[model samples]
Target: MKTIKILLPIFIYILLVDLSYAQSKQNKKQSLIKPVVEPPIEVERTTPNNPDQYQLRLIMENDAFGGFSDRYYTNGSRLEFHMSAGESNPTRKVFSYWNDLFITPNEKTRYLQGFAVGQEFYTPTNIKKADVSYGDRPYSSRGYFTNSLTTFTEDTSITTELELGMIGPSVGGKSAQINFHNFIGSPTPQGWDTQIPDSYSVALKTDIRKFYHRFFGTQYNVNLGNIQTDVSFGLIFRFGNVDKTPGPGSSALQPGSPILHEDGKGYWYFYVNPGGTLQAYNATIQGQMGSDKAYKSQNRSSAFSNWDSFLNNPTPDVGEKELQYRMLSEDNGKNTLQRYILFNEFLVNGTTNPYNIGLNYLIFNNIFNGAEEIERTTRLFLLSNLSAQWDQIPTNARALAIYSIFRPEGGKLPPIVRYYSYEVLSQFILDPKQRETLLQLLREEAEYRDNKTYIADLKRAVGFIRAGFVSVSNAGFLFGLHYNYQTIDFQAAKGLPQQHQWVGFQLGKVF
Candidate 1:
């Protein structure tokens, strides 16, 4: 045993020596790669305008294409519409439209905006049927109607909103609002799908500015309702005067904003958000399998002991036939699952700031403690970027970094922990010379990893040059190349099951 202990230390020392040597060699090879530098005068910037002003935006996602238009008319009325469609789900389409009419006379002090929206969503697979009785139904539908009126009091720094709405084939009412200098956004307590018929709820919100100093700002938002409760606090900081005007050139720059601006304009804003939420819901099951007690008893005995109790029921009865058909068609029958969840999250974001950073942390827990199992998870993420405004990189060129950690409770083996990724990005007029060098470096890295044994970890990086120019307002034909690298480790099960490394690279955007 003594000899084995001494040998183990020596073995670990030798392994560390080898790892250091390999890392040093890899770093030296990476340093040999050429770096591309661009002039600084090519960066872009944009300005902000009144929130009510009309704006049109088009977005193309990997799976869907969509556009939106928000037009605020001079009459204090607003109209908005958005629609999107996807290729795989061609039969389904999403539609949304809103119209707002000003009720209170528009003045510097107080005003009121009344609005209503109509939205429709369809999913072909939302409903499914099964041949077996007392089986799972897979279909579901979500529908809702909303109407709201908001009142503003400028002199008192107060605003109030009243809302009436409904959800899930049933109509519900929700109302909320915020006060001036008050951190919270809503005052009237909100409720959804409650058992009570046409009940009225109330809420109050207030905030104090300059909680500590000019650089430190604090705001709080809270809601008390029949079914849901929420509280959120935000801390904000502002730096550097930025143009806040509208139009292509007017700059209302706020620090910490995304620094994609036209020439000669910049802004920054920083904020941190901490919030908690609690919600409770009750659901009733009917038809075929019907309620939880009925399903439990039925599941225990394959024989239909209560066939008459379940089938002979009439319309609107606990076990009706048509409702059962609809439930089965929509794939709704399951083990009568009921669940409650509690969660808290912390968020930080830097907007349009030269140096931006964001951190998000969330913890969730299941509340049901009966025969149903509960689950919990904790997640943390960090994102940081340094702008290239001082460097002549592409408008979107920036140094980016991300890190994340996730832990799940009630699981075997220490959570499958992992740490990954670090990258630097730059874009300039496409340069064939730089592109060739990048490809050569990537090939070398691949070869080196392939040649190693006990290669517990590997690092791979790649770069691409894109030349297609899709012009959006003369943003000057977009052209650039991107590089990405990933490193992974794998442990030798016999020696140290924890010691491992794996990394690879592919061409094109890292996504």
Candidate 2:
């Protein structure tokens, strides 16, 4: 009986062990046979023959052309407009738009990538505006006997340009093109006071960088045109399917990216030029006046004394620095010569205009030191930001402001000003409070009579820059404040100025 009991227990134990092993093996087999649920594979979807595939581009330019004729200044300002280095600047506000014609197949070629045709319009809104004779002359009966006279007319015509451009291969993240442009203009009033003539001319236009075939990251463009030598600097923006893939004669962005049209793809935009070409003009008014014979003999006029003071004074008022000169009044009764100052300031202490900056960006890179250097560098890079705004802050105030911020032994800057200095120095500006405080400080600084008007001007300028630079919405949009100096090669020798300097700003977007 005892043996039977022991054997029964042992047999039950063996059966339990076998059953457990079998269950584990079955579970392993089931796991091995099961199918894996991989994360669903995603294929990037592409639109075929999308109506919204067309590409659109708009470029707004502020151009200045300056030059001096032999009839003008001889010695001091002779080489002034060598490029854009001259003091006399004639400015133009121009806007252009172009789109792909959907006809160019999205295929790559050795030279051709895509084709486009567009129109450009420009108006010369200069303060002391002048006229130039158009190169094209219409056949008129009045000119039969005067054919040899070569009478030139004024340049009061509205200018229009038609452009046919072909895109080239992409490099880095941008593409380039060759633009063949035909220009036509509206006729001026039927009078002798005509401005630029309504003439037709063809120009071959290309970016200066095209010489190397490498478009540098597509942020800025330096364009040069033939015949008239129309030089332009511009900003570029892009939207739509940016083709990151590489191929022969390919663009960083896909060709035919749609514009803001019915088949439009994105937001529509319009830009307000921060300051107009009015800022670019300077009036040159000369008048003949009769001086009293007695006064002339006495030579008692303070002009020489004023001149002496200007040369001797270590720091003179803006008006005292030979900035104004006297001329005889038109009225014979008045024995005094009327004094007039050159209209433009060029006032920001020690800075050169755009042409020199372009030619020597490398050398001047590290010229400024410490806080002053930072301020000056920022002023130069944000080209559209008027220098007069920064210039309005006296150097002592700037040094004091800096000392308050970084110097261990100095008084602290007003909390708001202190924060602003840091923010301005670091391009990552954000706080509105700082801006408000800075304005307050500006108001306080403007209290003095000597600087009241200038300080007010500075405040206005700061507010303008704040709206553009500090606003988050404007972050995507590119803003540029540039000084433009373009050399004017006048084919005809007349009273034309050779060198030009224009300080202007541009607002641009890519869509």
Candidate 3:
């Protein structure tokens, strides 16, 4: 009975041991067959398209500083086209192929990086002609009598600009940009010595913005080539997708399209002017008229005395009296030909009262096409000039008299003053072809005045000729109007009439 009990215990122990071993093996097999469960991972939802990679822009602007004018508060106008390129986001990897090329993605870099290029042209108005040779004209020793005889002048300026820049990431909602603008100033062909030879300028521009992805911003400008600096602001509107998020899927392992978005639309605008000009200089005529003795002392030349005597003793037969009279005038400070006045004579009608005058000037411009894209501008001016008294010759009349020329009519009636018409053409003819012909005619007239024969006749007929006494006294009162047009864009056919005037920014001492 003892042996049977020990054997049974031993067998039971062995069976328990075997069962525990099998159970452990079964657990191990189960572990191998069932996959391990990992902790949950977060998957961020991303947009379908990446950010914009390229941008194009059109710009128009006006600046009061750094213009053609030497006066304060003058403005220049500009038109421009621009483009830029850069990596929208370098951190986000959109394709695996570039990975093989070893362009590592940097997750920390989240801003746009790029470079830009632009071309522009600027036109500066309200500038003065500083050169004495071209603009100066001389006449009469009565210095107080004629301001136009010394100072009637204009300047022409056109500048072409090329720009380059590096674009930086947005800060405080404003995109940062560092730009270099280079430009050259060209002189007007018709104007004398208006060209500033070998002249080019450069400007550094810094910008910051935030409106529809940099639509509004403040600009700080510095003229690197000159002593000019400016600060201005601008606004722009953008109409297109402006996001830069990588899409879902295994784009990280495959190639993808680089273009972020389709076409975009935007327009930028800005204006910068210091202020309207103020009246500062002593009025020329006012200063001269302060004393009668000073005026008479200044006008005591023999020529002046003779002209005065003749004007006071005019008779009907005086128109028939022929004598040589030199047509001379003071230019800046020296003597020069009265070309401008003579030109004006060919186009304007004048009266003894300097303020009473009528004038017209027209320009037909074909900027692009010869005839199809022709444009036109007309300028009309009228002024009043009144001095106390002047002598005149007997009025001569001929049925077929050319307006500027007079034929002798034998008659001596009385001493009298006369108003004269210096009309080159009786009425303006507006035909396009005729206008071209008119320009040629004007050139011819200028040549005619240069001819020796014409000059001799003018000298001999001075007192007798109706337009002979070209006197400018009290020349300040002037009224003028201009009509202008230009074509901006051919594709959109955009254009409008722009109004301009010779008078602006009356500040004295520009330097």
How much lDDT does each candidate structure score? 0.20, 0.21, 0.19
TM-score of 1: 0.22
Per-residue lDDT of model 3, residues 1-511, tens digit only: 1222323344345435534654675466567663666423212112222222222211112222223222111121111111111222221122222221322334321222212222211111211122112111111001000000000001100111212211111010010000111122322211111111111223332222223232222211112212112332222222222222121000100001111122232111221211111112111111111222111112111221133233355555543321211121112212222423442453233423222222121100000000011011111111111111111211331111222112111111011101112112222322345445434444443343222110000011100000000111122111111111111110110111122211211100100
Q: What tens digits encode model 2's per-residue C-alpha lDDT throughout 1-511?
A: 1222323344345435534654675467567663674433222112221221112222222222122211111111000000110111111111111112111213220011112222221211111111111111111000000000000011001112222221111110010001111121211212111111122223332321111111111211111221122222322222223222110101111011111121222222222212111111101000001211101111112222233343343454635543332111111111111211121122111332222222122111211101111234544553433333446544543453334323321111133433333333322221355445434543443232111110000000100100111010212232333333333322212223434343333332322
Error of 2 at 421 (Å): 63
A best-first ranking of the candidates according to their lDDT comes to 2, 1, 3
Best by lDDT: 2
How well is each residue in 422-466 modelled by candidate 1, as lDDT tens digits? Answer: 011101211445434433443443344223211011112211111
Runs off by more than 4 Å, candidate 2: 1-192, 201-204, 208-476, 491-497
Q: Write down the lDDT that model 1 would get.
A: 0.20
How much does each candidate deviate from the true structure in C-alpha RMSD?
33.3, 30.7, 32.4
Deviation from native of the Cα of residue 246 in model 2, angstroms: 16
Q: Per-prediction TM-score, please? A: 0.22, 0.21, 0.23
Clashes of each: 55, 27, 18
Q: Which stretches of candidate 1 lie over 4 Å from their true place?
A: 1-159, 169-271, 280-511
RMSD of 3: 32.4
